[model samples]
Target: MRKLYVWDPLVRAFHWALVAGLILNMFVTNPGKTAHRWLGYGVLTLIALRLVWGLIGPKFARFRSFPPDPAAALDHAREIVTGRVHPHEGHSPLGALMVYNLLASCLIIGLTGWMLTTLTWFGVEWVEDLHKAFVTWVQLCAVLHIAAVIFESRRLRVNLPKSMVTGYKTLP
Candidate 1:
């Protein structure tokens, strides 16, 4: 086994920050409250920062490190079903797809949320409904993300959650 440094500090910070902001907005803060709006802005800012980092960050932190490839994801799923282990040092193909999914979903949520505060879109039912839909999508994705992480961790014998927390993955 070898310990590889994968996630960067900024990446880890962004992940936790986004998690906190999402939890705050989804549960603790009311939609119309100032705190909720600011939290949403903070989450959006973190995502924007993450997008920039995905272009120029460290090796494993860059999006290029884990391109979204359907073929690769299929192979990964096949391996899982066939009881073959292929441990990835960075984000796996399926995980990369999830990352992109969450990023896009969050972006939509944030944009529609901001639109709600605009004069033209204020009190617009469609915009509000769209925002809520994205929020629900993200919430579902987050749960799936967590479950997949745990499942992959055991399957691959790598602590994925710990890698995100400690910036290192012990690969077998």
Candidate 2:
């Protein structure tokens, strides 16, 4: 086995921060409270920072490291079907799609949530419903993300979640 530094500090921080913020908003913070709004804003800020980091951050942190390629994702799926192991130092192709999905979902949720606070959108049923719908979408994506991480970690013989926490992946 070899150890490789994968996730950078900022990337790790963003991952855990997003996890915490989502948990807080989903359970602890009431949507009607000022604290909830601030927390949501904080999450939006984190997402913005992450987007910038994906452009200029370290090698593995950059989006260039894992461009969204449908063919590559299909190949990864084939590898899984054939019981072949090909571990990526950064994100696997399917994982990249999930990252993009979560980012877009969060942005929509944040924007809709902010719209709810505006005079024009305040108490607008559809806008509020859109916000709630995205929240649910995020929640579903989070579950799928976790499941995929676990599956990949086992299939690749790497502690994927640990890599996020410690910025290192022990690969065989």
Candidate 3:
């Protein structure tokens, strides 16, 4: 096994912080409460920082390293079906798509959540509905992301979760 530095410190910190904020907002903090609102703002800030980091960060942290490519994702799906293990230094194609999905979902959730606090959008049924819908979507995507990470880690012999925590990948 060869160990390679993959995720940067900012990337790792963002990942865990986002996880905590999402969990606290979704399951712990009551909606529209101060804690929930602050957590939502924290998530939004993390996303904004990640966006800027994607532009100026290291190789594996850059958007260019894992651009959302549907075609490549499809091919990756085919590879999975065929049981071919092609380990990626960064995110796999399907993982890239999931990353984009989660990012957009979190952004929408944050925006709608913030909108709910404003005088204009407060008590607006549609905005509230959209916010709730995105929260559900993010929850589902988070599950899928976790399952895929575990599956890929087993199939590819890479400790993906550990890599995210340690900023290194032990790849075979």
lDDT of each: 0.93, 0.93, 0.94
Candidate 1: 10-residue stretch with minimal lDDT: 32-41
Model 3 clash number: 0
Query: Which residue pairs does candidate 1 place in steric collision?
Result: none
For 1-172, candidate 1 gives per-residue lDDT tens digits of: 9999999899999999989999999999999789988888998899999999999999988988998899999998999999999898899999999999999999999999999988999999999999999999999999999999999999998999999999999998
Per-residue lDDT over 1-172 for candidate 2, one digit per residue giving the tens place of the 0 to 100 score = 8899999999999999999999999899999689899999999999999999999999999999999999999999999999999898899999999999999999998899899888999999999999999999999999999999999998998999989989999988
Residue-level lDDT tens digits of model 3 in 44-86:
9999999999999999999999999999999999989999988
Candidate 3: C-alpha lDDT: 0.94
Give the clash count for each candidate: 0, 0, 0
Those runs of model 2 whose alpha carbons end farther than 4 Å from true positions after fitting are none
Query: What are the RMSD figures for all models against the true structure?
Result: 0.6, 0.7, 0.7
